[model samples]
Target chain A: MLQSIVHVCLAGLSQGMFIWLVASGLTLIFGVLGVLNFAHGSFYMLGAYFCFMVLRALGENFWWGLLLGPVCVAAVGYLVERFFLRRVYGLELPYQLLLTFAFVLLFDDLVKIFWGAASIGTPPAPGLADSIMILGRRFPSYNLFVIAVGPLLALGLWGLLEKTWAGRIIRASSSDREMASALGVKVPTLFTAVFVFGTWLGALGGGLAVPYLGLLTPGMGEQIIIEAFVVAVIGGLGSLKGAFLGALVIGLLSAFGTRFLPTFDMFLTFILMAGVLLWRPQGFFGEAR
Target chain B: MSKKGMNRRQFVKAGLMTAAAAALGPAVLKPTSLWAAESKVKGPIKLGYQTVLSGTLAGYGEFHKMGAIMAMEEINTAGGIAGNKLEIEFRDSTLKAPDAIQNARYFVDSWGADFLAGIDSSGQALALAPVMAELDRVLMVTHAATEKLTEEQVFKNGVKQIFRIVTPTYQDGNAAAFVAKDLPVKTWATINPKYEYGFTCWNMFKETLSALKKDVTFTAESWAPFGTTDFRSHINTIMDAKPEGLYSVEWAGELITMVKQGIQAGLFNQVKHVMFPVGAAMDVLEGLGAEMPDNIWISGRYYFLYPNDKSNNDWVERFHKRWQHYPAYVSEGAYSTMYAFKKAVEAAGSKETKAVVGALEGMTLDSPAGKRVFRKEDHQAMYDVPWGLTVSNPKYPFKIMGKQVMVPAKDCFARPPFEGPGTKPPFKA
Candidate 1:
């Protein structure tokens, strides 16, 4: 029983890490731009597809994909923000929402056109395909890598935000856009930069998750986007820390729920989200408006 | 006397009537000659094909499309169907029930489709069944495998227009159970998608397998929503249960993910027999490629390389030559559906919907999967379900099943009409 519990916790942690990776980017984009990028998940899908293509073209060197895939997606994100999203920045929330949603459809169809709507899988990286015995329970090495990377990323992001000048400007712009512009912060450029970075994070998550997921489909983004949204809403729409907490909560609930209440497992996360909303309508970390 | 009152107009009409009767005298005497002339110049037979054509399951839909198209081309090449060419109007259902129903309506109302076929999801088929009855059109279901679509929902509701070409969930489960009894595994666990198809499949497997292997026991069970990408938590739970075998109802992308994750988590190493009733599909094998582990048991509605009979092998060879890939079960199903429609139309001696339905009730035809017969009582086709063990074949790029076991149609099913106890009790809403 103890061993099983440990295994479940480890599984939850790995899942939570992936969820955090996706939700953090979503929350960040919403926080800075005040536009919920519905196409954020499409970027993640593009990352996976790009990574798979790169890996195949480069003789299955998974490392090359890990590095270059996100760069490609980030470049696309830059173009999108510069051309399309920029026009909607000054418009009402619904216009921005509609534009992003349109991107989602556009990207989905583009993937179908290129990838042929078939699901394809990428093998795990060399040396990470196997499992290791931890505390007498077999756990996948790739999962452990994911779990380790998540906290390190969180720490790095924390350091950048708290200790860097660029991070300070970003924070200032997010909190007081008009004041930041008045103080000569170049708020527009900062918003674009934040959007690019957030998109890069989303794509990076996708690339990281591909080996574990082992399959890519055109509709993959649509499946995960809802979960990311749930996490963002439960954690407070714009709070990175809250995104992490919310992801972990949902992930653990998923793990334990499948074991105890197999029939109602899907509803467990929604139930938790509802409970949190009832207690704290603004979310645990959202600023009171 | 009339001529005294009539002018030149009456005289002209009389002369024209005499000329018309002289010209049409032979055709009026023998109406069969006129009908024969019209038959030679008959209009094309139009079929409306709808399925999930643009989503994750699009691969399945694509195969169905290819099969239907190939059948149409082949039929046209062979002087068309009774000298009338077959044409198909394709639509993407988007894997939604409402969209499927709407598309069915659009096909009949707007396109004047002679018949309707193609539904990849069971829920979509069931939703469209009543719509078919409402439209008074015959719907040949090619891929959806829910037993309730035939036995309970369509049966109890008296929807005779819905005919299933592919085997249902119970048939597949019962077939897999035959293979399971011969295996040495004593304990098993199940992981399936949470839906009508999944539940029915698992229940059928359990009921059949338990009956055969009385000593065997089920240790754990897990259900995930359809289209779920992640299965790590479920894998861990099943692993903890430590069952000797695992039966999974996951298919397509979901199955690929689970198998890959299971390998990574060493779940396969622990479980002795990992069986997937629908995992032997070409899409699954091709998606996983070399990543698919050898010796795992998988089954499908059809196997491209099976039956080893000359005719079936020739058909498969032609399919590969035309499509440049192996045909999945749905491909065969859709292909056979077109031929079945042609045969039924010929038997009915007319293109009327009711006549075709009557002709199709007890229709039998030879297919790539061998002979198939549509049960007159329930409108479900009876054909062999193939299951086999995965092996790495040098001739194929992906893992192909070896030690093939083709469960006979009679063995996989109960007596016809399927009016037995309900497979699943209706929801008390």
Candidate 2:
């Protein structure tokens, strides 16, 4: 019984970590930019597909994919922010949303055209293909690698945002865009970089996920986007810290809900979202309006 | 203004006309029958086909199109059906029920399709039953495998316009049980799709397995929702229960994910006996390729290599040469359906709906999947599909079934009424 509980918890943790990889990027972009980039999930999907390309090129080394897949996605993010997203920065939220939503449809169709509508199998990470014994139960090592990396990346992001000068400029621009521009900061360039950084995070999650989930399909990002929004909203939109914890909470709830109360599995996430909305409207870390 | 515009009396007349339309039919409007009454049933015999054309299972649509078009080409080359030039129009039916229903109507009403074929989902097939009856167009269901489409929709409910070319859950559930009962396993667990097809198959397997074996118990079950990318939690649940055998009815892309993840989590290592009802599908086999674990049992509606007959083998070679890919069950079924139409229409000597249906009722046709007889009772094609263990064959790139077991259809398929345990060999669990 204890072992089963441990298994569920471990499974939930890995699931949460995967969601965090996607949610972290979404939180950073939505929190800082006040633009609900619906295409953030598309970025996550592109990460997986791009990672597959690299993995196909470089063999099944997990590190090669992690190193290069997000870089490609970051390039995409850079272009999107510079040409398209740049036009809608100060525009109304609906305009930004409409543009991102259009990209979602475009990207999904583009993937189908390029990759075809069939599912593709991804090889496991080179050495972590085997399951290790945990609590007298076998668990996937690829999952363990993800769980470990989720927090490490969170810490790395924290150090970058808190200690670095570039991070300070980003904070300044996001909090007070006019003040930063008046102080001679290249605000548009900073926004582009920040968007690129967030894109990288989402892509990184997708790259890691290719080996973990071991499959890719078109419209795969659509489902994750809904869950990530729930996590982001619950964690207090834009709060990186909030996304991390919220991902864990959502993941565990999904796992347990599917197991114990299978009927409520679909509604449980929304119920939590509704509860959060009724009580803490600003989210776990958002500033009160 | 008074001459052009409506007065109170004119407005009331228009309102009455609107209310008449509203008060007419309780459900579906019956204009399809009048449209069918006007159908010329002459010149070219047009067939409208639709399948999952743009999602994860979009490959299925490709396969369906390949087979149907191939068959259409062959027929047109051979002077067409009933001395008329056979014409076909393709539409994306999508996964939704309403879309499928609309497509079926469009095929008959607007597109002037004499015949309709290739439905992918059982939900869509069931939804189209009454609509097909209203349309009076003979629909040959190629992919959807829910038995209810045949038994309930066609037989019980008297929705006779529907006929299934593909073998339904009988092969997946009861025939699987008949094969599994001889094995030593006792405890079984299942993870299946969350919809009607999944539920019916699982129940059929459990019911038939229980009847066949005295001691077997269903230990655990996990239902995977549509578009489930992860099965780790379901895996955990099954492992916790520690069943002797795991039977998963997950098909296509989802099955590929489940198996790949199963290998990673060592689920296959712990559970010695694993059976995938539709694991032998072309998409699953091609996707998994060399990594598909050996000795795992798999079955589908039809396999390319089965029958081991000259016609079947010759058909397989031709299909590969044409499409550069082996035929999936849907492909074979779709191909067979086209031939069935030819035989029916030629035998009837008319493209009329009633005449073709009459000829098709108990018609036997020779095709790639061997001889298929559409059961007059429920319009289900009674055919053989084998269950076998996966093994790498030198002739093929992907894993092929080795040591195949062919269970006779009569031993597993339900009797005429198909009501319950009292009426059939395999019943609801």
lDDT of 1: 0.84
lDDT of 1 by residue, B1-429 (tens): 445557467546545654664476456635543354345334599899998877678777888988999999999999777779999999998988978976887787658788999988888987887668767679999888888788765557778898998887855578878788899988989888898888888888888888777898988888989877778778877887889889988999999999888887778778979889888788999999998898999888888887779988888889899988888888999999999988988876666666778889889988888889998777889888678889998998899888877667766665545645532222122
Residues forming the 10-long window of minimal summed lDDT in candidate 1 chain B: B420-429
C-alpha DockQ of every model? 0.54, 0.61
Error of 2 at B120 (Å): 1.8
lDDT tens readout by residue for model 1, A1-289: 8877788888888888888888889999999889999999999899889888888889898878989999999999999999999988888988898899999989988998998877877878777877899777678888899999988888888888879999898888889999999999987788889999999999988899888898888868877778889999998999888888888888888888877788788899999889878988768788766
| Second chain alone, TM-score for each candidate | 0.87, 0.90
Q: Considering only N, C-alpha and C atoms within 3 Å, which residue pairs clash in candidate 2?
A: none
Q: What tens-digit string does per-residue lDDT give for candidate 2 at B326-383? A: 9998899889998999998778766767778888999998878888888999999888
Q: Which residue segments of model 1 deviate by more than 4 Å?
A: B1-41, B420-429
Would you estimate the TM-scores of all the predictions? 0.92, 0.91
